[model samples]
Target: MSYGKKEFRKRLLILTVLISLSFLVLLGRLWVLEIIQGEKYLFLARNNSIRLLPSRAPRGIIYDRKGEILARSRPSFSITIYPWNLSQEDLAETVKEISPIIGVKEERIYQTIEESQSPFNNIPLKEDVDLKTATKILERKLSLAGVDLQVQPRRYYPDEELLAPVLGYLGEIDKDQLQALRGRGYRLGDRVGRDGVERVYDEYLKGEDGGWQIRVNNRGQRVGTMGHKEPLPGNDLVLTIDRQLQQVAWDSLKGRPGAIVVLDPNNGEILSLVSAPAYDPNLFAGSLSQEKWLSLKGDPLHPLTNRAIQGEYPPGSAFKVITTIAALERGIASRDKSFFCSGTFPFKDRVFKCWKEEGCGTLNLKEAIIHSCNVYFYQLGLETGVDNIVDFSKEFGLGKASGIDLVEEKKGLLPHRRWRKESLSRKWFDGDTINLSIGQGYLLVTPLQMANLIGAIANGGRLYRPYLVKRIISPEGETIRETRPRLIKEVILKKKNLDLLRESLFGVVNEKGPSGRRTGTGWRAKIEGIEVAGKTGTAENPLGEDHAWFIGFAPYREPKIALAILVEHGGMGGKAAAPIAKRIFEAYFNSKVGEKKSRKVEE
Candidate 1:
C-alpha cells in the first residue's frame, strides 16, 4: 500500500504501456471491419431498409389470322409480406389478422415467410385475391404491419377452353425451372409457359420485367420511391388459324372424344385445329387446387391429351388409298384390272371377311377404292406386298412426324416385316398383310397425319410441313417473322396415275353406283355446287364401337381446304364423320365468298 517516489513512477509507466496496447488492438479490429469488408457491410446495411420489388410484365396478345384476340392479360390483386421489416411478434399478428380474410391458414403464411431464401424480397402470401378481400386488408392496413397489397398481371383466355390445347397456360416456376432459368432473370414465384405455343414461343411472348427500389418504414409501409422502371409488353402473335373455322370444327365434334383438322392443302397453313373434351386454360391462370389437378389426371377420356397429333389409331378403309397408290406405282395393278369378291377371302388358316356380308361382287382398282371392298384390297395387298405399301406410305409422310410446328406430335406405327419379328417375336404372315391392306391391323396413324396425307394428294404429290403460326408481330405492329409454305417432300409418280387416282377420289364423293342403288362411301360429304373428293374409314375397336374417319378436299380441280374429321366410338365413317366434313367445307367456302364480296364493295 506504501511506495517510494521511484516505485510510483515505475507503476505509472506500466499502466501507460498497457493502455496504449489496448488502443492499438482496438484500432486494428476497426481497420479490418471498415477497410477490408466495407463494401459487404455497406450492401447489407442498404438492403435492410431499401428493397427491390418486381413488377410483372403483361404477356403478348394472341390473335387469330383476322386480328381477333384469343389471349390477353388483366390486372389482378395479390397480398405480400416483407418479413425483414417485421419483428417476430409483428409477423405473427399480421399473419393471424389477414389469414381469415385471404382464405389461407396462418400456419401456411408463417411457413412461407420462414422458408424464403431472400427474406428481404417481398413474398406473395396470396395471389389473385378478390377485390373485396383486398379492400378489407387496405382498411386494416394500420393494424397489419409488413402486409401490403400489390397489383399483378394475370393471364386471361377469352375463349376459355376453345383454344386451350394450342395456346397452353402459365404456371408458377418450380425449383427445377427456376434453376434452369435463373440466369435469364427468372426468380422464385415467377410464372412461365407450360405447353403448346406458349412454351414454344416463350422468349417472344414473355417480355422484360421491371422493378423499383423503394424505401419502407419499420412497419413495411412504403414511404418513398427511390427508383422505378416501366415494364415492356410482349410481342403479338398472328396465327394462321381462322376463328370462325375453329368454331365450326368444334361444334361439329359436339364434345366427342376426337379431333378435326382443317388446313390449306397447297401451303400447309392450318386454318382450324380442334381437339375435343378440352380443359379450360383459365383454370390454370391462378393457383390450381391439388384436388382439381388430380381429377384432370384421373379422367378416363384424358381431356388433357391433344388428340389431333397424339392420338394413334388404325386408319380403317382409309388405308385403301395408300394400297391403291402402291399398286399403281409398282405396276402391279392397272386402272382396268378387276378382282372378284364374295364377302370373304380365305388365306392360310383364316378367313378375312369384307365389311359387307353380301360382297361387292366384281370391282376394278377405282371401284375397289370407292366401295372400300375388304376382299379386293386383301388380294391387291398380297400381290403388291408389304414392302411396297410401306415405301409409299413413307413417301406420303405417313408413319412419321409431319414436322408440324407444335409439341408432342407422335410418329404413328408403320408396320413392316421386321417390326413384327422385333416387337412381337413372330414371322410376318399373309394375314397381317391382309389386315394392313384394309387399315385394320398394326398400322396406326394420327388425325393430323391423315390430314397431311390428303393434303399431299390434293396438292399433286408435294408434301408441305403443316404449320399453325403464320407470323409474329411486334408490339408496335411491325411484322418480325413470317412463315411460308415449307415443302417437305415431292413424290415421284406418273402424271397419269395421279390424275386417275384423283378422278377416283372425286367419284367417292360425287359418283353414284349401278343406277343409284349404292353410292360411294363419302357421298354424304358431297356439296351441290362444289366438286369434293374424299375417302371414308371405320377403324375397328375391341373396347367399344368403331372409330369413324373422313378425309376430304373440296373444289377438286383447284382445291382450297383439306380436312380430316374423326369421331371416337362412332359407327360408320360415312354416316358419322362425312356429315361433319360437309358442314366444315360449307362454312369455309361461305367465308371465302363473303370476304370476296366485302373486298369488291370496298373497291
Candidate 2:
C-alpha cells in the first residue's frame, strides 16, 4: 500500500508538469498574437469592419485656343456588388434579380464577382447604367442585399469625330496596365488615355483619386461614414488649335483619303490638323460594342491612323525645293544655270522619261521649278550628287520626324549610298541618284515634315518644334505651364538665295503663262488678296494613281501660315492638291480679316 501511494504521487506530479507546460505554450502563443503580430491582426480586424471606397476624380477638360470645350465629364451611374457582404445564396439571388434589369448575363455577373481581386471591395456589375434601371435597383435594394448604385464621372466628348484623333479616347485599364500602374493608385475600373494628346499628357490630365472609409456591418452594408477625402480635379489644357480652322481643314478634305496640316510658321503653333476617314470618339466613351470596334479595326481606309505625321510618301516635285537648295548651296547650279529638256534623261543605258513628252525646251532654274521640268531636276541632281542631296534633304527636315507632339510619327526614308549598299546590297548607281533627285526613288517624307520644312523657309530658315498645347491651367485658374516657341534648327542659306527661291515659288502660283506654257503648275492656288508661293508634287505610287501634294505659305511677303496637303491616289498636285490649298488660304485670310475688323470695332 505504501509503494502504490508513492507511484500514484509520482504519476500525479508528472501530469501536473504536463498541464503546466501546455499552459505556458498557450500563454506564449497568446503573447505572439497580442504583441508581435498585433498590428497586422488589428489591421485585418479593422478592414473587416471599415471598408475603403475609392472615388474617381474628374479628368481635365480640353479646350481650343478660343476656350471651346473639346472634352469634359458627365455624371454616370454604375451598379456594383460587395462580394464579401453576401453569402453564396444571397449572391445568387442578387445576380438573378439584377441581371435582367441591368441587361447583363447572370453568368457574367457571377464571373465578375468570382474574378474580383478583393471580396471586400466593390465589383462593378454594370457601368453606364440607365436612370430607370438605377431607380429600379434602388427600389429593390432590400432584395439585392450586396448590390449598390454609385454615381461616377464618365468622359464625354462634345464634338465627337471633329477632334477624335487629336483628343483621343479613354478605356478601362487593362490587366497589364493595371499591374504597371497599381502603385500609382490606379485600379481595375479606372479609365486611362489610349492615344494622341490624351495618352501623351495623361500624367497631367489624370487627377489624384480620393477615397472614403465607411463603417460596415458583417453583412457588408454601410452603417456610417467613418472618414472621407475629396478628389482633386485634373488640370485643364489649352491647345493652340483654332476650332474654326480645324473645322475648315476637316471640311476641305471632303471625305477624301488624305491629310491637311496648317501651322503658324513663325511660332510652330499648329492651327489645324486633319486626317481623313475620322471616326466618332464618342463610340469609345462607354463600353465599345464588339461589332463597332471590329468595324473600325478592319476598315480598309484605316480611319484610326493619323496620316499627317504617319503617312510616308515621296514628296515628288515638291522636293525640288530641297534639290534646288542642295544645288545652290553646293554651287553646282544657279538661278541662271540652264538645262535643255528633250522630254527624256539618258543615264548610262536607261532613259528616264519626263511627264512633258515634248520636253520643256531650254529652261533656267527658276523656270524649271515653275514648270516642274523633270529633266532639268535630273541634271541638277546629277551635278549635286547623291551625298549632297541627302545632306540638304536632312537639313530641310526631310526623311525625319518633325518632332511634333503627336505620337507614331514616322521618320521618312532618305536613301543614301551606304543605306543602299547595306539595305539592298547594291552599289549606288547614277539612276538611283537621278531618281532620288526628283524625290521619286526611295525618298519619302511625311506631310508634317514637309510643312515644317516650308515653315522654316517662310520663317526665314528657323525650324521650330511643332506643338499643339499652348498652355496648361490648374483647377484653381492659375497657369501651371505655358509652351513658348522653341526653335529647333536653322537652315544656313544666303538671304539672296532664299529670296530668289521665294520669288520663284511665288511665280509658280502668281505668275501664269510664263515660259510660253498655258499656265504655271501652281497657278490654281492663287487668291485675289493673298499672294501665295507654293510647290506642287505628283508622287508616283506603285499601288495606284500618283499621290497629290502641295506645300506653301500664304501672303508671300511676311507669310504667317504654312500649309501642307496630301491626297492619296490623286492624279496631279496642280489639279488635285493646289485647289484645296486655295480654299484653305481663302478661309484663313478671310477669318483674319474678320478678326481684324472685329478688333477695330472693339477699339
Most accurate candidate by lDDT: 1
> What lDDT tens digits, residue by residue, belong to model 1 across residues 1-603?
456878998999999999999999999989988999776668657765687788988888999999899999899999988877467888888888888999999888878877887646788888888889999999998888877788988999988888987888888889998988889877787778897788778778888889888877777777778998988888888888899899999988888888998999999998988888889999898889899999998999998888899999999998788998999999998889899999988887888899889999999888888888989999999999999999999999888999887788999999999999999999998888888888988999999999999988898998999998888888888999999889998998888888888898898888775687547999989876889999999999988999999998988999988989989998899999999999999999988889999999999
Model 1 vs truth, CA RMSD? 4.2
TM-score of each: 0.92, 0.90
Off by over 4 Å in 2: 1-49, 174-188, 216-219, 289-294, 514-518
Task: List model 2 lDDT by residue over 1-603, tens digit each.
Answer: 999999999999999999999999999999999999897668657766787888889999999998999898888998888876456887788889888999999988878778887645788888888899999998987788667778888888887787877888887789999899889878777788988788788778889888888876655666779899988988999998888888888887788899888999999999888888888887787778789999999999998988888888899999999989888888888789999999998888999988899999999999998999999999999989999989988887777787878788899899999999999999999999899988899998888899998888887898999999999999999999999999888989988888888988998897757475536799888999788999999999999999999999988999999999999998899999999999999988998899999999999
User: Which pairs of residues collide in candidate 1?
Assistant: none
lDDT of residue 392 for candidate 1: 97
Error of 2 at 363 (Å): 1.6
Give candidate 2's TM-score: 0.90
